[model samples]
Target: MSKKSYRNKIEIAKEKEKNKEELLKKIERLQKRINDLEKSLNKPQNIQDKTELYLKHPEEPVVTPTLKKTVVNEQILWEINNSQRATKGLFEIKGNYEKICSIIPNALIIADEKGKIIFWNKAAEKIFGYTSEEALNNDLLNILVPSEYHQFFKEGFNRFKDTGEGPIIEKPSEFIAKKKNGNNFPIEITLSAIEVDEKWYSVAIIRDISEHKRIEESLIQTHQKLEGMLNNAVNTLVKIIELRDSYTSGHQKRVSELAVAIARKMGLNEKKVKLIKIAALVHDIGKVGIPSEILNKPTKLTDLEFNLIQTHPQAGYNILKEVDFPWPVEEIILQHHERIDGSGYPRKLKDDEIMVEARIIAVADVVEAMSSHRPYRPGLGIKKALEEISQNRGILYDPKVVDICLQLFREKKFKF
Candidate 1:
């Protein structure tokens, strides 16, 4: 009860605590020494002996009782910290997934094996006119497909689920879909599948193609109309030349047919073949101005009259040059009389200098003119006409065109 007695009691309690701490330290030192002795003994033991020890004491911990192994609290703390960091990472990943679903314009949706909608995004609402909450757990086909194609779509989708083969998933398909208002329209659709927790889900990308199809049809119709108008114009131009000279009226006609034939046999293109026909029709159009006596004379003309006849080509060029034709009209009219070897013509042009169309007309003109009778002279016949060109192939005509013409006459027995 006295103050001195209380002080003595406090000192005795402190000394007892100090002695207890010393005893614990001595025990730890002895345990470490015992652990070192046991490890040295276990090193030389065979695996069979170690297995027997494990079997005999199955409940015992792997560490020895002698080893003073304190729990590594710092390592446990490190592992706990790592687990918390991993959990935080998983939460961030979940947030990113939600963000992506919101931003992607394409319908990032999932449907179960039965074609029931599971997850839908904002794009699905915009495109299909169904909100995410309304679409979930609803049968996708019944919601979007027209009544006529619903059964067909069911068969196709079920087939894909069973066999992993179907036309819809492998390639995009065109299908008619009905809107919420019951209006139907064409859509291009692509489908893909993904497995989530052992169940397959399908996602589709759809685009409306009604406008594209309309534009394509319009282009086709316009092209056909333009082609018809062009043909009518060409026919009218051919008729005009036929009305001019009775002697050469049908002269241009027969020559046009034969010229186009020869051009095709020579492998000329459609454009060049058309040019040859138009050029042949207008070859002697200049004769419209010449006196009828000069053009349709029943007898041979004087030297002066023949010289005036040569002027028809220059006159034809002047007439055709003023009016626009798609072809090089003036060049066609000018070069028709110009020979390949510079031998026969108003202006003596030669060889490749002459256009291919003009070269064809030259052969056609010579052949038809000589084959058919003229008012001034008797017919030379097709034989002599072919003979004339064959004999003077390189001399007065292009040799390649000349050869094809001869082969047609001789071997093929080609008729006018």
Candidate 2:
């Protein structure tokens, strides 16, 4: 084919693709309107303001209430079970359904379109402390639903009455429900819309979740207690390190404070920030093995003594490695001296090879060590400490950690 003819074919194909896209967009818009119309159909129509609502008990002998009953005598139940309008779907009501509802652990209630109770199972009686006789012919909202939830029922019941559809159908939701003595308790309720002889009915299967909630609260308290004990153990280790090196008594704690602040400013999740805090608090644990004379030595230390000091990171790692922490605590301690350019001590790890936790502690360690008074020299001051990290941002330390540290001190007004 000629070049001009091929170009024309390509242009035609492009136009066809554009038309297909526009058609799909129009279909999506039409689908949204159809969904809105279906929702509107859920509004109530032709529902009576007052009607007899019956409450039936299929398990035991009948005690008929004289309230001009509108309910599930055997004929209405037969209508529900055998109606041409009844479709087999979620929570389908069938023959012997009342026997099953009566035996099930959950409380079962079936209300007519007007929100009047018609069926109350044996479990419902036990949960709500209402007999079938007392509960029968009563408005479901007035009897069992709490006042706070009345608005939802009023809105929802109308939709179910009109179109046999509502948000509460086909799924479970949690709410507070009223019991017999006027006490409110948590409940997990699953509702469904059923149609019998062209009339929509609302069916609910509710479970009292008071015990589940109590167990959840108990577990939270137990977790908090365990957290307290873990913190106490970490503090004891901090004290051990401080007691051994008097010149750096609060060094580990100050580093931890700064490291945590930097981690938070960097937008790390709380779990990771917590791990950094714990590692920073005990980063120098290996120094505990070194002689105190060298650790607290006055004036500048000899080369041999300085070499011994570098071994502290590995020493801290060895001691901490034996612990079974959920985080990489020992690794962070080992790499705290590591630099992005592989200039750090102990292992000489570089860049991405080092853990982020170690990177954060390294910056905190340097700032605290230089700013605080040491047995060998007077304090270097915070300005000089900031300059040290700023000078070697990417070369000696992590760039991101450095930037956040700078922001924490400069912009966030973070304190050690």
Candidate 3:
């Protein structure tokens, strides 16, 4: 009874193993049949049936035509692998070009070699009131160039077409271009030629530079107005300095008169003459900051007091340097006390460093100060004044500027 039962259990186990092997072989045959059906459906006529099957299911998986295109060549497969990067780069360039056109507030056009428009950004629509579709087929010259420039446009275009060269060599040329509303406006146009498929095309970047030109002109006018105001302010400041020190009243004016005469004799230009005149008027402006007691001291200045008096020129530079006067008032004040051989106070600039304007003013300052009475000393007459400069030509005065002063006093008979 036990042997029979063991034999029955063994037969059942063997039957189960045989049934499992039969099921595995059936699954393998089914996979092969599916693969063969896919190949058969890829044929031209069977494709319609496969599409109908997909349509019936709607969500059934199927390969796309794009997948076939991606495998067209090894180069294409590599390009497909990098397609996301390529697409992102293209979108960035498009966005940049759009942003540029948006900011410019003018029409921009890119044309092929056949004069067919290819690119028309947003500002082109805003300015010319034309859509990208309308702009694409239009001839650029016909759209923007006025009737008068037709012959000129033809000549230039033909020249570029024939020789791939022309006279429009600069970055841009300022010209008038007509708008869609038939109004004329100024434009600055820059053009560069590009080639694709062995054909020449142009990528011209156009901007309305009229506003920039207007701004530049306004700045020039403002600068001129500011210069005039500074001159008036300086003159007023000097008058106030003179009013308090009545004895030195008319001192600067007389020096300026003599300085002008000497400068004319020296054959200086109008600009130099003007600089000399302004320098003469403000040569003693530093004395304004000096204490009135020291300036009008009846007794002789002590060594420390005299050292304090010598700081006037540096004070004058500090004051005038920030005033925005067209004349170099800072240099004039700095160099007025500077001797020709570097032997004067506060930056003793010698030779060419001492501007000719300061040299002329220096001579005039001494002549005026010596010929007129000061708190420090009584007046030395014109004869003694002439001798002082003559004794120290080149050593103290610039010889050429000094000679002019001597000639003005002696030969020209110019007097205060």
lDDT of 1 by residue, 307-366 (tens): 888888888899878765656967888889888889767778888888888888888888
Cα lDDT tens digits for candidate 3, 1-416: 23355457546634533442233223223322333334433444444564554345432222111121111111211222233543454454445545544554445566766677877878677666668988887998898889888789778877665444556622567788888888877777755554333455555656665655565566668767776887888688778878767655578888889988889888899888887888777777777777899889988999998998899898878878888777687788778888999998788788788888888888888888889888878889878898999999999999998888888877856998
TM-score, structure 3 vs. true: 0.49
* Global Cα lDDT for candidate 2: 0.73
Best by TM-score: 2
Location of the lowest summed lDDT over 10 successive residues in candidate 1: 72-81
The deviation in Å at residue 73 for candidate 2 is 27
- Answer with 1 or 2, whichever has the higher lDDT: 2
Q: Against the true structure, what is every candidate's RMSD?
A: 27.2, 17.6, 25.2
User: Of the candidates numbered 2 and 3, which has the greater lDDT value?
Assistant: 2
TM-score of each: 0.51, 0.66, 0.49
lDDT of 2 by residue, 75-137 (tens): 332233222322331123333344445455678787887888988889899999999999989
* Winner by lDDT between candidate 3 and candidate 1: 3
Q: Which residues of candidate 2, in runs, are more than 4 Å off?
A: 1-93, 99-104, 110-113, 147-173, 191-203, 321-328, 345-353
